[model samples]
Each structure stands twice: as structure tokens, then as C-alpha cells.
Target: MTQAAADPRYGAAPPPRRRWRLSWNDPRTRNLAVQAAAIAVVAAAVWYLAGNAGRNLAARHIATGFAFLHRVAGIPIAEQPIPYDPATSTFARALLEGVLNTLKVSLAGIVLATILGTFVGIARLAPNWLLSRLAAVYVEVLRDIPLLLQLLFWYTLLQTLPAPRQAVHLGPAFLSNRGLRLPGLVWQPAHSWAALAALAGVVLSVLWARRARARQDATGVRPPVWPVAVALIIGLPVAVWAVLGAPLGFDVPVRKGFGFAGGVTVSPEYAALLAGLVIYTAAYVAEIVRSGIEAVPRGQWEAAGALGLRRGAILRMIVLPQALRVIIPPMTSEYLNLTKNSSLAVAIGYQDIVSIASTTLNQTGQAIEGIAIIMAVYLVISLTISLFMNWYNARVALVER
Candidate 1:
């Protein structure tokens, strides 16, 4: 063998030293270079677009700043939960009121939709053919329809109801085209204290339940949790209320000459929006719930049954906890969707954030400012929900060693 070939590290002319290239020849360097180029292009495009917008606004004699935020909105919002006067409040304040109304509708819709969806989802799995088919029909029909059309249908249906003078009475409640009147709770200072105490008690009960569950898992003995939960959630509140002189009263709805009187009336627009949102969103939520429940392995059911657990116990103890891990992420998305879809309130003359912002834009010719406000409000809501959901997901995720 030749002297050069005898040394293992020495090859035949070292295979011609290839120069390291910074281009696509090297995968890592090429990817980094491509990403850098893409970022620069995007940055340049954004700057150009922003500059064009500024120039266009200036040429059109419109201010490009946020000074319009402080100007008076000069519009009255009927049926605001918080006290709002157009003459006294700034455009910002009116926008805040609209945001709150949007939140109220979305929050209520999420709660109602979850309850209805869960029931319908469980029903779809029924052993009885009629019950399962009924649930399937509901899911298919509702999910197939456009949400906007649903909203319109609900609004039209509400408008066709009898006028205030001939309102339908349901015990202490009244229903009419004008609104649905229900009894309102009159609260005193003591009621506030009772509410605070009740909230604290509920929080404490949840902590106790968590601890009890951990102890039970370690010792193979489950504690009686329901009675403690009930006491903390219900009895504590009642106890505090009694101690605080029971400062609570109901203002029941009563029939009056032209309208119902002495109760809180929810306008038809609000009712229609809420009802449509809940029903439409519930369809999607039902599907998510059904899929989640179905994803739980059949072995779990069999194992629980073999352990002599009742069907309800098997569902509550073994099935739901596992199913929730799959359910929560998609459920969070549905909630966020419902919140954004609430913007459709504009179609029915409901004073939601989008509707109010549109009116403000038309009145002040401050389209940019109005759009910015709407976008920021929605972004905040989306971010807040995403953060909470991510935190919850992390907590519930399966652990591995």
C-alpha cells in the first residue's frame, strides 16, 4: 500500500476540498437566509402600505390620530345595563358600554349553549333509537343552517309576538314584542356581603374537594363530597344572608295598561340575539361534545362496570374526566367563536360593539379610529380567552414520566 493510503485519516487528495456555500447548497443556512429575506419583504410591504394609508387620509382631510376617541359620540344607546348618556359621555365611554353589552350576551350564550349542548350530546348516544335520532336531527339541522339566517329568523319570530298591551303572562313573567319582563331582585348592602361570603365559601369548597380527591386516590377511599359542596355553595350563602338581615326582595312583573310594569325587561333585540347565538353555537358544541365522549375508550366503560359501578358512577368518575381532556380545547374555540359572532347583533339593531362602532364611524367620519377600537376590543377578548384556555389545558393534560 502507498504511504498516504496506509494512514486511514488521509484520503485520495482529500476528495477536492469543497468550499462551504451560504446558499441553498446548505439546508440550515438556506432556511435561515430565506426566512430573513421573507421577514424583510413583509416589513417593507407593511411600511409601504402604512405610508400610503397616511397619505390617503391626509389628502382626504381626515386626521390620522386617535383624537376622535375623546369627542362626544352624540348618540343614545337604548337599553344599556350601565348608566350611559350621549350628551355627558365621550365616544370612548359609549364604545366601552357597547363592549360590555357584547360581553354580557356572549357570556350568557356560552353558559346556556354548553348546558344544552351537553344534554343533546349525551342524548345522541342513547340506546333508544328514537332519542338518538332526535338528537342527530337537531345537530344536523342546526349546524347546516347559516348563523345569520338563524339570527334573522329569531328576530322576526320575536317581532311577531303580541304587543305590550296584549302581552302573554307566565305567572310573574310577561312576554311581548317589546321585551320579556321577568322579576328583578332588589339588593341591599347586606346582600353584597352575603354574595362575597358565598363566593369565598364556594372557592374554599372547591379547594377542599380537590384535596379530598387527592387523599382518596392515595388511600383508595372516597370522601363524601356532595354534602360538603352543597353546604359551602348553598348553605353558607343562606347563612350569610340570614345574618345580614336577608336584604333581598323581588320586583315581580305586573300587567299594566300599555306594557308590563315593575320588573326588568330584556328587549326583543337582545333576546333574539342571545337566543340565536346560543342555539347556533350549541349545534357545533354538540358535535364537539359527542366526539369527545365517543373518543373515550370502551375499555374504560367495561372496567368500571366490572368494578360494580353504576352507569352514572362510571360516567361521572371514569368517562367525563377523560372526555373533558379532549372536549375543553375545542369547547374554548366555540366560546371564542360565539363571542366574535355576537358582532352580528348589528343585523338586528342590537347595540353591540360592532354596531355602535359603525354608527360612530358614520357620524364622525373617523373610520380608522372606529375600526381600531373594534379590533382592539376583539383582540383583547380573544387573547384573554386563549390564555385561560391554554392554562386550563396545561393543567388537565395527561402526565408522563
Candidate 2:
């Protein structure tokens, strides 16, 4: 009674304190709920689209299944690296062959473009004015033109050569409208062993270089790693070849009535496609390289020179190491672009993945499956390249504090 008289506002019982529950009222929980709702909407949309596609296919009297892949591909391919018989192989095998060819071209193009681009990039930075200007012009001219035009130009140039019957002979090689026939290396079992040894030598050399760099970092003394690495990589392979009795033979091309006999003939279509891809892609790669090199601060070069390092040493040790961090990521994209651009082979009848897939689509009337296979192959290639480049980029990335 005395407390109530002192505080009339304080009733018989205080109001219960409000309790907060750890639930969707939290920001993170609310965000999660929103994301879940969005995903459900997307799934519903996909289901609706898929249902529409099913109805459309049914109305067109088209069978929607992968069973057609087993059917025989009646059309014959002109030049397959593997042993493929049109009458014996299924459509799946034909598609596989096409995919392999595409891979071959893309891989070769990447290697060639990298070498050419790096050289051109370095040349553009040369102290010699003429050389630098020349490289600049090359990059500019090639990059400006469409790749398709370049491909056609090369194909036409090749076609303008003499007929196969009167081929322009260059020692053991012959050039004609049909193709350029050069000496082919006849591989023996021992050659395969030598190749394996070369690969092992490269792996060993990389490991050795890494160890040497680690040792140098610990002691602050740089050893002559380049010569040692090169010797290990090249000399080991040569030694392996010598040990295998040097089993090497070349098949020279000889003019035979209507065509060249022997030797490995590179079809004009393949040559044109390769030339176009390399030149066009090299221009872009050159730009990337140039930008990367330029991104390296002038202070780095000045510091290296102040340390009494030679120009070559500064470039090899200081400049390039840092420049590569900038170069690799964009360079990888260019490599992928070149790979996909190789589909332009259809214009020149090179029978690359797209060309072959298109042919299959026409013949089998399985547009969906044919297109899916092509997409899958390209997706795999792009993913593989991205994974490798990302791993390499991570290795070279600057360690931050």
C-alpha cells in the first residue's frame, strides 16, 4: 500500500518486457529468404519454357531424344587425322572426329600466336626506331581487318598457285592449288619414347627452376638458371633420341602426274584457316603484351639499371616477371577467342567443329542434338583453358599484406 501510494503509475504488475526472436528479422536471414524466392521463380520460368519447347517439338513431328546419335553418318569426311570410315562409324564418332580436328587447330594456333605475339610485343619496345614502328604497323594493320576477310585472302592466294600437275617444287616440298606438300616425319616406336623423355625433361627442368628460385630467395644470390634449364630440357631429349639409335626418317614429296605423292600435305583450307587465326589473334595478343609491359612502372626499370643490371637481365628478371601478372589473364581470353573464331573454317571448307556439325545437322535433321554437342565441346575447351589460366594467374599473383 505504501509503494502504490509512492508510484501510482506502477500498477500491480509491470508490463512484460518485449523479447526479440533470432529469426528472419535478421538481415542475413531475410536475404536468404529473398534468394530462395528468386530461385523458385527462375525454376518456374525454366519449367514453363521447357514445356513450350516440348509442345513445339511434338507439333513438328520431330523425335526429341539422343537415340539418333547411334545412327550411321553416311557422309564421308575428306581429310580426317584418325582412321574414320563413314560406312562403319556412327554419328557420334563422326562428331568426335570433328571435335578432335577443332582441338588440333586451336592448340596449334595458340602456340604459334603466343610466340609471334611475344616477339612482336618485345620488338615494339625496342630502342631501334624502325623496328618498333614496323611492329606497330603490323599490329595495327592486322588488328583492323576482319578475320574472315584475312582467311579468304589467304585461301585465294593459295588457290592462285600452280595446278598439282605442274606444282612449284621447292626441293623436297611441292606447292600447288591443292595443298602444300612438305616432308613428313615417319615416326617409329623409339620416337615416341624420345617424345616422352622430352616431356619428362621439361617437367624436371620446371621443378629445378622453382627450387633454384627458392634457394636464391633464401640466400639473395641468383644462379644461372636459364642455361641449366634449357640444357636439361633440350639436351636430355637429344640424348634420349641418340640412345634410341636416332630412328628418324622423312617422306619427301614427289610430283606424280596429277598430284603430289608422299609427304604430309596441308590442305589449302587448313593452311588459310591457320594463317588467318594466327595473324588475327596475334595482333590482339600483341596489344595485350604491349599493355602489360607498359603497365610495369618506369621505376622498376630505373631501379634495376641502378643496381648495375644489364638491359636483358632487367627485362628477363624484373620487368617480365611483373609484366606477366598483367599479361596472362587477358592473354588467356585472346587464346579462347582464337579457339572460337576457328569456327570460321566453315567459310573455307576446313571441316572444323562448326562446319562438320552443320553438315551433320542438315543430313540427320537432328538440329538440337547436333547444336548441343557443339556447345558442349566448346564449353569444355573454354572451361579447361580458364581453369589452367586461373591456376597460373594465382601462382603469379602478388602476395598482399
Candidate 3:
């Protein structure tokens, strides 16, 4: 700098580099300051609104807080996964029952929708033109129809079915206006113990799989996982059942007068809701799956095929795994949407959380608390789903060696 500046050959030395300062003139500083101000404004607005609500509630002599949760709830819920007596149960218990009911439908819908959607998505790209077209039509029709309308249609269709005595028989199951009656287990303590063992076996199988996968990465050869998984998950459960004196009783349904008795009853309300949610959500999920599969380069398929791999093998072994990285994020949203969409159960007289809360608020006139409970329930559910899906997504993400 000294020689060049003195000689005027390199012009003046460049100005000293400026150190960033937290001033209004600096863009980064100004942006942060603006964000802080916006956040403060939002906080202030929330505070004012909350204070006003409290004052209004107080002025009206309306009691607040969650004390009403302990009060008896007289709302009759048709489908309860847990024991719930409307006459004796508190609002808290009733609401808990509602939560369980919502979860029942939501969990089932997610599983069924995933399965159906994946198949339809694959069918969309099938070599058979008719199958592809049919799949396309199915996706288009389902996506275009409003979910609420579909729910209503399913409900109406179920209601029009023949009565209990004239139920359409399908093997051990029967469908009628009352509900679908299916064979069920005469559950026992032994069965419960076996189920617990099976769950433990599943956890152990997952651990074993991880170990096997790690071993495969370190060594070229991988150990078979299925045999060990089966031994743990199935054999362990059977052993537990046998040790506990295996009880294999079945609760077969029998026509008892006007209605069926024994076994399990899939109420029309639940069936309609479950069917509608799965079918409608599957269309969106199908599109997502198709896009994800398509995202896998054609070269991948060609490479796998060139190695003498069948189309199914290429898809299951290679393409599907790669496609998962693309599929999981949007798939998470579909799951959330299905869960949230279940709130619509109230429209068809299905006693989900929203329905129970609405009834509780109406009878008790504790609208704020009731609504808060619903918001909290959904918030918890959405967060849990998001967290699980994000974890899965990370696991499937590409890793560079």
C-alpha cells in the first residue's frame, strides 16, 4: 500500500473495511428493530384484548376458570372408546372420551389413507392405460368434491341400508342401518398381557433392525431382519399367550330380535366419517405420492433394471426410499389435514371433541373454557404429528459420506 499509493500506480489504497454497528442506518439493524417493534405491538394487542375480555366477563357476573370441568356432564355420547357414563361422568371425563373418539378415527384414517393413496399413486403411472385413467379419474373426482359433502353422502347412503335383521352378510360381518357388526375377540387379561408382550417385541425388533442396518453399512453383507422380527413380534406374543393359558374366544355376532348382539359394532356415524376422511384425503395424498415418485430420476429405474432387477424390486428397494425424502414433508400436512378435518364429525352427529365441547359449553354456558380445551387438544395433536413427521423426514434425508 505504501509503495503503490506513493507511486500513484495502484491509485489510493482501498478504504479500511467498515465494522458493522447497530445503528438505524444499517439495514440489518433496522430490520431487527422493525421486527422487535412488530412483536411488541402484537404482544400489546394481545394484552389489551385479554384484559378487556376479563373485564367484560367480570362485569357480566359470569363465572370463569375451569371449575366447571368437575361438574357433571349430561351429554349423551354414542361412541366412546373408554367407559363414559353421561349421568355420573364429569365434564373432564366426557371431554377426555371425546378426545379418544377423535383419535380413534384420526389414527385409522391416517393408516388407511396412506395405504390407499400409495396404491392409487402407483396406479396413476401404471403401464396399463385403463388402470392409469381410472386412477386419474378417481383422484380428480375425489379432489373436486367438498369433504363435507362426501361425508354427508356417505352418511346418507349408510342410513338407507337395510335394517338389522336384513343386514347384508359378508362372511362373519354384517352391514345394516344400525351399524356394521363384525366378529371380535372376547378379550381377557391373558390377551392383554400377550398384547403388551407384542408391543415390547415390536420395540425390540426395531432396535435389532437398527443394529443390522449399522452392521450392513460397516460390512457388505446384511443379516436377515424378518425372521428375527417375526420371532420377537409373533413368536414372543404367542409364547406369552400360551404361558398365560391361551384364551381364543371369539365374540360372534348374533341377530337378537330387532338388532344384533355380541361382537363389535362399527356405528354408522363412525363408518361414514372414517370412510369419507380416508377416501377424500387419499386423493390429495395420491397426487403427493405420484409427484414424489416422479421426482426420482428415470436413470435410477434404468440403472436398477440394467442390473436385472424387476420393476417391483427397483421401486421397493431403490426408488421408494429416495422418493420418501420428497414425500414425507407434504405427507405430514395431509395427516394434519385429516386429523383437523375430523372436527367435521359434529355435522353428522359423531361425538368428536368439537361436538362434546359444543354440547358442554351449551349446557354449562362456559363457552370460553370449552373452546380453549378444543384449541389445546388440536394444538397438542398438530404439534405431536409435526414433530414425529419431522423426525422421520430427517431419518430419510440423504447423508453424504
Each prediction's TM-score against the native?
0.87, 0.86, 0.90
lDDT of 1 at 315: 82
- Scored by lDDT, the top model is 3
| Predictions: Cα RMSD each | 6.8, 9.1, 5.4
lDDT of 2 by residue, 1-401 (tens): 67776786865477886565558887766788899999999999999988997898899997777776798887788668887899988878888878888998999999999989988998899899999999999999999999999999999999999998878878888888999899999988888888887889889888988988998999988777889878877888788889889888999888777787788988999889889999999888888888988999999999999999999999899999999999999988998899999999999988888888889888877788778888999999999999999999999998886
Tens digit per residue, CA lDDT, model 1, 50-147: 89999999998986677777888789998687888899888888888899999989889999999999888888987889999999999999999999
Candidate 3 regions exceeding 4 Å error are 1-35, 170-172, 214-221
Q: Judged by TM-score relative to the true structure, which candidate is superior, 2 or 3? A: 3
Residue 182's lDDT in candidate 2: 96
Model 3 accuracy (lDDT, Cα)? 0.94
* Model 1, runs deviating above 4 Å: 1-32, 210-224, 253-261
**What number of clashing residue pairs does each candidate have, in the order they appear?**
0, 0, 0
Of models 1 and 2, which has the larger lDDT? Answer: 1
What global local distance difference test value does model 2 have?
Answer: 0.88
Regions more than 4 Å wrong, model 2: 1-24, 207-232, 235-245
- Model 3, residue 172: distance off in Å is 4.5
